[model samples]
Target: MTNHYYRDFLIRNWQERDRIPAAEVIRSVLSEYGLGWEPNGADKDVLQVEEYYLATGGEFWVIEYQNQLVGTGAYYPIKRSEKAVEIRKMYLLSSVRGFGLGKYLLQQLEAAIASRGFLSIWIETASVLAEAVKLYESNGYMPATGVETTRCDRVYVKSLMTNFY
Candidate 1:
């Protein structure tokens, strides 16, 4: 068995073989966040959203250990009056928890956004995703008032003042 900790995981652009495993990891994480998937209903919606993100200029960074995908972080431009981008889906398989990978992924995403001259990065997450909420908070994102979704999603925004590249 691969030791996830000792293995070198590369974070790179998404590929075709990554689709299914990435979807599965995200589905599992969403379930843990109380956003359970239903094959014929919400699950389909989730998949469609993923497809839409890919169709746009969205980029997915997949983490692999010994050729096995274990997590993903994606970002796409969101329609806004000001230059901004959104951090869409981000997930790490259970085995990689507590390894600082989340922070690493966020940093990369932020750098990519900033490099594009976007002034801010925004993200939304259901309230049940406490860990995600904390991650955003710790990374300088501030809560913003917005129309809540059926899933009680909360919006957070982080301003990127300088180019990180």
Candidate 2:
């Protein structure tokens, strides 16, 4: 899950010990966007990245900058006939906002999915997450036709067939 380093940043696969710190990174970023963190909610998946992401024929990645877990991103398998994955938990601390790390993470995630032979990627995001929406759109994620409720109001999709991983 490594990408050419972003400054001193290194991307690595999510490990069991990263659970708490990774959740902190995610929660921190969400908080900046005025999003509330409710542990009792469905976001409990953030606390169990292994079971919901890694163990589900998918993967989660953490980016370390200066030995600190500053960013987190993950893609997990979903019930789609075309070998699809959902990009989830993509967030970064405000300190790393303009360093091109988000783009790198998106690139790496798509490569990881394509490496595993997945055909497409799907993502859901709230309308309030303008930066995230821009990142997704710039990374080739277009509007998805599916109807999704219960969480995000915007859904996006991108096909990862160019390099075939």
Candidate 3:
């Protein structure tokens, strides 16, 4: 099944057409990660691609299946930094896992980041997301230690130029 399935996926910078599906997929993925809940009057906590679009000139890629959104990923410049970008808010619907979509997304994100003159990229995922960690490792990202953050996340970093095929 994995080899036979091909995603009708299109990745682009955020646009008005993507508002609802992007929001819903983000909410669903965050819920799966236990990070979806938002308190009343805290709508700002929701990470909307459109909002990031306006703020950081960030780029968003949405995966669609039969015209329905099923996955997304984004890249944004890190603040106070030069030539560095962060791969943020990457998620795919559960049904799409194990078919190499994650690898594709990572490669696309790295390409986008590098195109913008960024020399390196980093991502932080929950330590419990072992599959994600392995994906990063297999893609040449090294585990980063001693990152102090409240989220207790596991950090991974990779230099974009080191292992290009």
Candidate 4:
């Protein structure tokens, strides 16, 4: 239950009421990119944020622009390595794109991860998500393999041990 303000947007922890709207925002963004929304599959976590994220020692956030939910992002620990986390569900509506909020959200996520003593961060995204790829690369995430999600084709990893935070 934390709140972060950036310009006109408010980034805060996910709540029960945000489930539907946040799912809609994510589904809509995936649709805009011609990708399918896998509710029972890859995206089941969106329906059970508490169980998948909050309860599992991870964090989920919803982005509000003018009091409207416009984006979502989350991360949870994974068994891939020691003290590692995978960034998930980072989608922003087109209306909110190009405003650097995505980058800001990413920085916030990274700072939180680093502060929590996480040593590694991983991300998976599709190649069609060109903007996402550019953002990750620009933020020091090097290309990697072994993507675990069906919707993603590209993988990136970053070590939070240095120059991170």
Candidate 5:
């Protein structure tokens, strides 16, 4: 389902070949905010994208710029609210900030989740990620609780039942 192309960037489904570069991109982005990549803890999914995402009812995507893996975003059905899905692993390289790619990827994820019959979407993020918080809030993700990750301080949810798209 590689249908998105913005400027010179491309968004496509994750492949086995993307594992290493994708992990590098994710770790590099996390390090920018003084966060560590917890492959055995918070980020265990990155190491098992097949089992945790694709093998389940979820999808994971990789972002490419000039043929280089630069970002990632994914969502998996969670036992949360009605038909809920948790948006996870959204990260972009520092050089790609302010380019609207994050917003585009988020919108794409929402569309996919809704199309898959998900009624609500949840996101857990740290307050340190001011831009991410702003993006989610601006896109109608209201404040919520139940943050399960140790690194995250907040959780936000958007009800897709009211969304026309």
Candidate 6:
């Protein structure tokens, strides 16, 4: 809704009830791709907010510009893996797609995750999200074999270290 020239959007932490709007954007976008994300089911984390994202040594950021939420990105350490973090819930409004906000959010999230001492950032995206796959590929993410999840098919990993394998 915010259509102003306010330079770069600001990334803010997801506060209480903040997930409502974020979920709206996410569900709307996912529905466009014929995907389903149920809040009380598969995406219960969005409902719990702090308990799932913040309390766990991870972060969720909402991109706001001129007081309107436009995008979101989140990360948390992979289960049972101390050296890796999983990138999650990246979505941007259709009106703001070509503005490089997705790339910006990825770069920023990578930096933040690395700074948290994570050696790698992991991502799982659907085969349908070509632009997202391209963004991750261009950002130095390598296709990786990992735990199979029903949420997505393509898996990518970004190493925060040069030779930490």
Write the residue-wise lDDT of candidate 2 on 1-165 in tens digits.
655577788888888889899889977877887877756664788887767886788788888888899988888888754788988888889898888888888888887888888988999888788988999888788897664534578989888775544
Q: After superposition, how far is residue 67 of candidate 1 from its true place, in Å?
A: 1.8
Query: Which scores better on TM-score, 2 or 6?
Result: 2
Clash number for model 2?
0
Q: Residues 101-150, candidate 1, lDDT per residue (tens digit)?
A: 88878887887777768888888777777778889999999888773345
- Counting clashing residue pairs in each candidate, in order, gives 0, 0, 0, 0, 0, 0
Question: How does residue 127 of candidate 3 score in lDDT?
Answer: 71
lDDT of 2 at 16: 85
**After aligning candidate 5 to the native by TM-score, how far in Å is the CA of 140 from where it should be?**
0.2
CA deviation > 4 Å runs, candidate 2: 2-4, 145-151, 162-165
Give the TM-score of each candidate: 0.81, 0.89, 0.78, 0.96, 0.97, 0.88
TM-score leader:
5
lDDT of 1 at 20: 77
User: What tens digits encode model 6's per-residue C-alpha lDDT throughout 61-100?
Assistant: 8878767777778887775355888888898877678888
Stretches of candidate 5 off by over 4 Å are none
lDDT score for candidate 5 against the true structure: 0.93
Candidate 3 local lDDT, 58-151, one digit each (tens): 6777777776778877777774245667776677888778888889888877766776778778787777666788898898888876553344
Error of 5 at 89 (Å): 0.6
Q: What residue pairs clash in candidate 6, if any at all?
A: none
lDDT of each residue in 1-165, candidate 4, tens digit only = 379998899999999999999999999999999999999998999999999999888999999998899999999998887999999999999999998999999999998888888999999899998999999999999999898888789999999888644
lDDT of 3: 0.68
Error of 2 at 72 (Å): 0.2
Select the stronger candidate by lDDT from 2 and 3: 2
Ten residues in a row with the worst lDDT in model 6?
1-10
